[model samples]
Target: CKTIFPNLFLIIHRNIVSTVNLACPLDLKSIALQARNAEYNPKVLSYSAVIMRIREPRTTALIFSSGKMVCTGAKSEEQSRLAARKYARVVQKLGFPVKFLDFKIQNMVGSCDVCFPIRLEARAVSWIYRMVKPRIVLLIFVSGKVVLTGTVGI
Candidate 1:
């Protein structure tokens, strides 16, 4: 016999990863010096990218010389997009001709607690669960908690 618990889970998005293209090459050294909340250490990553952070959305962005940016630490898709735009705006304000292009939500991570113990041995699949969608993966624990990752959308 099997039991179904309907509406037993409420997932909270923990992190959202997104990418954006600025559509213009960036001068990392200039950005590092001119932009506030920006950090760049050539010895650290060999001048590959500049790391910028914003406090409002609490997100971090990796900005590359090719005008590519990756934003992370947002809790929702909207926040992720907003943060990316904020980053673009910062660069644009720095006198760079930047256009926000190809903003994409690369991955989302969420977790939930069911409030009951799950018997993993009974399922015989161990702890890791892969969804039909190639990008999604779930981790089920005996404590009835689940972590879902790599989802592109809600």
Candidate 2:
């Protein structure tokens, strides 16, 4: 039964990063205080944006003051969108007019092992290699660890 489809490729999605526009201004300090799962630190340069997390989809979102949100850690495209919508709803509930707009998948990452060590040195590629397909980057390691990134969808 397993040999029937030898060409079947399994792309194990490790994570999906997506972006969405709320189309309205947001106050990071207010969101952090109102949303239980949201955190914001204005003094910290690394955490300039409000970080929000959801348990249902196990995704985290970075909410900027400009109403732009970046959602990450979803296993699939649908999951990413669902998580982003959830984040947007949370903001909307905080009394900010939220409009879900320009929702797009920024990057999709998939990882797989070839089951054998790869000779990356012979390839002489840089730390990261790009796939033949446009907008696809493959990070191949010597230990047979391959990461496929820069894809918009699964």
Q: Report the lDDT tens digits of candidate 2 across residue range 17-98.
A: 9999999999999999999888898787666799999998999999999999999999988999999999999999999999
Give the total clashing residue pairs for model 1.
Answer: 0
Expressed as tens digits, the lDDT of each residue in 1-154 for candidate 1 is 1336756567899999999999999999999999999999978885589999999899999999999999999998899999999999999999999999898998899998877778877665349988986678999888788899977874
lDDT of all predictions: 0.90, 0.86
Give candidate 2 misplaced runs (Cα > 4 Å). Answer: 1-8, 122-127
* Clashes by residue pair, model 1: none
lDDT of candidate 1 at residue 10, scale 0 to 100: 75
Highest-lDDT candidate: 1
